[model samples]
Target: MAFRGSLFKFLVVITLYDAFLTVNSQAETTDPTKMTAAILVRVDQSGKGDYTKIQDAIDAVPSNNTELVFVLIKPGIYKEKVTVPADKPFITVSGTKVAETIITWNDSENIFECATFTVLASDFVARYLTIQNTYGNGAQAVALRVSGDRAAFIGCRIISYQDTLLDDTGRHYYSNCYIEGATDFICGNAASVFEKCHLHSVSEGAGAITAQRRESPAEDTGFTFLGCTITGVKTAVLGRPWGPYSRVVFAFSYISSAILPQGWDDWGDSSKQSTVYYGQYKCYGRGAITSKRVGWARSLTSQEASPFLTKDFIGAKDWIRPAPTSFRTASKPISHHSDGNN
Candidate 1:
C-alpha cells in the first residue's frame, strides 16, 4: 500500500509538470505578427506598386475575418470607384496624410446611382487621405457614401460640391476629418460622431446639412458633432430635418461667422421642424454664442454630454480588433508638458 501511494504522487507531479510545459510552449510559440490588427498593403501611381488600384486589393482580401487590412498607400492620385462591401469588416484604408495622398474622381448629382466610395462594412477606417468628387456639384455629387457601422475617419479630407460625405448607414465615428461641400452637402442617414473634424460650406443659397431619414429616434440615426470646426463663407446652421425624427447635436464645437443667427433653416417646410431634435453644448467662436438660435434647438447640459463624450462612445469598446497575422505599431511615449494638452 505504501508503494502504491508513492506511485500515485509521482504521477500527479508529472501531470503538473507536463501542463506547465504545454502552457509555456504555447505562449512562447505564439507570434506577435499573427495578432496584428492591420496588414499594410501599399498602392502606388506607378504600375510597379503592390496593388495597381485600391478596389483590386480590397477584393483580394478574405471576408471571413474582421481583422483590419491597412492599405498603406504611397503618395499618389488614385482615381477609381471604391466600394467597401458589407461582408468585409474591420478594414482600414490609410494614406500618408491628407495633404499628400489624393483620391479624386468626378461623379455628380446627375449621377445618383454612382458614389465615390460606398462603404457597407463594419469598423471601416480611413486615415490621412483626400476623397473628392470633381463633378462640379450641380445635382448629386457624392464624394463618400458611407454605410458602415463603427466606421472611423481620422485626419482625412472629403470634398464635393454637394453631398460630400453621405452617412448612409449605421454608427460611425470621424476624428480630425475635413468634409467640404455646399447645400445639404453633409446630409446622410447614419448615426455618426464627428470629433475635431472640419465641416466646411463651399457654396451659396440653401446651404443646409443632414437629410436624415432616420428609421426611428430610439435607434440613434443622427449626427453628433463633438469639438468640430465649421468654416467657410456660406452661413451654416446645426442642420435641417431631412426626414421625420431627425436628430443632431453639436457639443464643444467651434463655429465660423457664416452661421445664421436663427441657427437652422426651415428648408421651406415648417412642418418638418416639429420632429427634428437639434441641440448645442458649449460652442465657441463667431457662429457660436447662440443667443439667436431657434426655439427648436436645445442646449445639452454637462450630464447629457457625458455618455456620448466618453471613450466608449468613440470606438473605445475595443481599441484593437484581432487578426491571425498583423503588425502593431506601439504607442509613442509622450513628454510631460505643463499645459496638459497631451
Candidate 2:
C-alpha cells in the first residue's frame, strides 16, 4: 500500500509540471515582448523564423536599448505601420532587397498620425527596403515619416501620391533613394540632405515638389539636394515656401523639363518672397532656367553653395563615415549668372 501511494504521488507531480510548462510556452508564443534579450530579431511571415510580425520583434527589444539591434527582415510584403520609438536608438533595419522587402501602410492627410514607417529614434538606419503608403488619391499620404537625429536611409524607395516622405525633424541623410510624390511630397522642418537620389513626380495637373518649413531665422533647418535627379509630370515646380524662412537648395542636380518656369513658389504669401531662401547651383536641364526662375529665387554663390553641398550640412561627417563618400570631395565652383548676384 505504501509503494502504491508513492507511485500515485509521483504521477500527479509529473502531470502538474507538464501543465505549467504548457501554459508558459503559450504565453511566450503569444507575447514575444516577454523576452528582453538584445539579440537578432528575424522576422518571417512564413512561420519558419523567430517572429511572424515586425512589430512583435521590435517589442522584444528592451526599452532605452543602447546596443545595436539588427532586425533582419525577409522578402515579403509586410503591411504594417512600424515605428522606431525615441527610446530605442542604434537600431538598424535591413532587408534582402529593396523591391523584395516592402513595409507599407495606408495613412492619409494626417501628417502627425499617418505614417507607414515612422522613426522617432536617433542613430537609426534603414537599407534596401521600400516604405510605401498605398493611399494614392488621399489628401496627404506619407510613406516614410522620419523625425530621428542622425538617421539615414539608403537604397530605399518611398512611394505615394502626396506628401510622400516627411523629414519632419532632426538631421537626416538619404542616399541613392527614390522619392515619389505630387505636392509637397518631401516637406518638413528637418535639416536633411539628399545625395544621388531620384525625386519623381506624378501629378496629373499642377504640383510642387518640396515644401520646406523653417519658421524662425534661428532655426537651422532646410532641404539640400545634391547630385540628384528631379523628374516628374511636365508641370511640377521645384518647391514652395511652407514657412516664411523656408530654405531649399539644389546643387549639382539634374532638373527635368517638368519643373515650372518659376522654380519656387511663395505659397501665395507675398511677404515670404523676401524671407524665403530658394537657391540653386550648377543644375543642368531644359527646365533649369535661371532667367525664368522667380526674381526672389537667387542663384547661390560658390561660398554659399559650398557649405550645403558637403555632408557636414547634416552633421553626418562624424557619425556616418565611409558610406557617404560622395560628400567628401570638395565643392565645385559656382556658376556666375547675370541675374543671380544677390
- Off by more than 4 A, model 2: 1-39, 321-342
What tens digits encode model 1's per-residue C-alpha lDDT throughout 154-255?
Answer: 889988877778787777777788888887777777767888988888767547755656646576567888888888777666577767677777888888
Top lDDT prediction, candidate number? 2
| lDDT score at residue 125, model 1, on the 0-100 scale | 78
Clashing pairs in 1: 33-326, 34-324, 34-325, 36-326, 108-140, 109-139, 109-140, 109-141, 235-258
CA shift at 284, candidate 1, in angstroms? 1.2
Q: Give the poorly placed runs of model 1, Cα more than 4 Å off.
A: 1-37, 109-112, 311-342
Native-to-model Cα distance after best TM-score fit, residue 70 in candidate 2, in Å: 1.0
| TM-score per candidate, chains pooled | 0.79, 0.82
lDDT of 2 by residue, 38-71 (tens): 2355678896665677776665454555444567
Candidate 1: residue 286 Cα off by (Å): 1.7
